[model samples]
Target chain A: GQQVMQIPQYQHVQEGEDFTTYCNSSTTLSNIQWYKQRPGGHPVFLIQLVKSGEVKKQKRLTFQFGEAKKNSSLHITATQTTDVGTYFCAGGLQAGTALIFGKGTTLSVSS
Target chain B: DTAVSQTPKYLVTQMGNDKSIKCEQNLGHDTMYWYKQDSKKFLKIMFSYNNKELIINETVPNRFSPKSPDKAHLNLHINSLELGDSAVYFCASSHRQSYQETQYFGPGTRLLVL
Candidate 1:
């Protein structure tokens, strides 16, 4: 069975600090998707990386896929109060397979 | 308009009860799925359907069943629920059956089994 593991199960940072969460998969992934779920909210798709060694950015957030496609990371710079939420990384194995989601890293930012 | 909608935002029932959660997607997606998020926030896929056909069925308990009446609807029925059944159930849909497709998730149904 394929598994997606995320690090730093929980994180708390000051408003101006930075945060990063890492994800590792037991097997190579065809694609990796990142999602954010606010408190009492549904998970929302943020970005997806399919290429090896791919890097994508959305404002202050940066996402990277490892060259081997077995790991990924999400980094947030100068976190804000609105950044408080749980970040999940889901890995896709193949075309017809389902996405395996990581346990997620809960981020808490205090102003 | 809501792309994916689920009925009964919250549910609380005693043990050994039977309950159903309905999900509808107006995004015209050809695929629908059900995911359960436990108290630890671990999200796991339960079932997936494509065009009213079951495509993926995880190793879920026999007490859980999924019904897709049409391409636009997928519902989950749980029978003889137990305390371990308490979790947030989310319904999501993608434009296609491909695993790489982006998924739009509903707000989720919070079920509590006492």
Candidate 2:
């Protein structure tokens, strides 16, 4: 069975501080996608990474895929209240297969 | 217009009753999926439909059935629901054109079984 796990299931940070969540897997992933879910809301797609050692930045957020494609990390440069939500990392089992999502890392930014 | 939509945004019913959640996507994607998010916030895939054909069926109970009348619509029916059936169910769709399949999700339908 392919399972994805995330570190720091819960995290709280000041508005100006930084935050990060790491994801690890036991098997190599063909591709990885990150999603964010607001409180009492559905999951929203953020970005996807396919190449190994890939790093992408979107405004204050940075996403990195490990060289082995079995681990990933999401870093928030400067956290804001708007960034408060749970971050999930999902990996596809194979081509044309369902994705397995991680337990998710909940981020709470307090002013 | 929303790309993906589901009916009955909220449902509360008694145990042993049957209920169904309907979903439709306007993106014209060839693949659709049904997922369950438990209290722990773990998203699990229960079913996947590729071009109206059942492709993936996890260890979901047989009481749960999914029907896809066409590529634009897929519905889920639960029979004799139990307490464990109370959770938020989400419908998602993705195009099969490439390997990087980015899924578009709809606002989930919350089900509460008492």
TM-scores of the candidates are: 0.99, 0.97
DockQ-based class of model 1: high
Candidate 1 residue-wise lDDT at B83: 99
Instruction: Record all residue pairs in model 2 with backbone atoms less than 3 Å apart, i.e. clashing.
Output: none
Per-residue lDDT for A9-59 in model 2, tens only? 999999999999999999998889999999998899999998999999999
Predictions' DockQ, in order:
0.89, 0.66
lDDT for model 2 = 0.92
What tens digits encode model 1's per-residue C-alpha lDDT throughout B13-109? 9999999999999999999999999999989999999999999999999999999999999999999999999999999999999879999999999
- Off by more than 4 A, model 2: B97-99
Indicate the worst ten consecutive residues by lDDT in candidate 1 chain A. Answer: A94-103
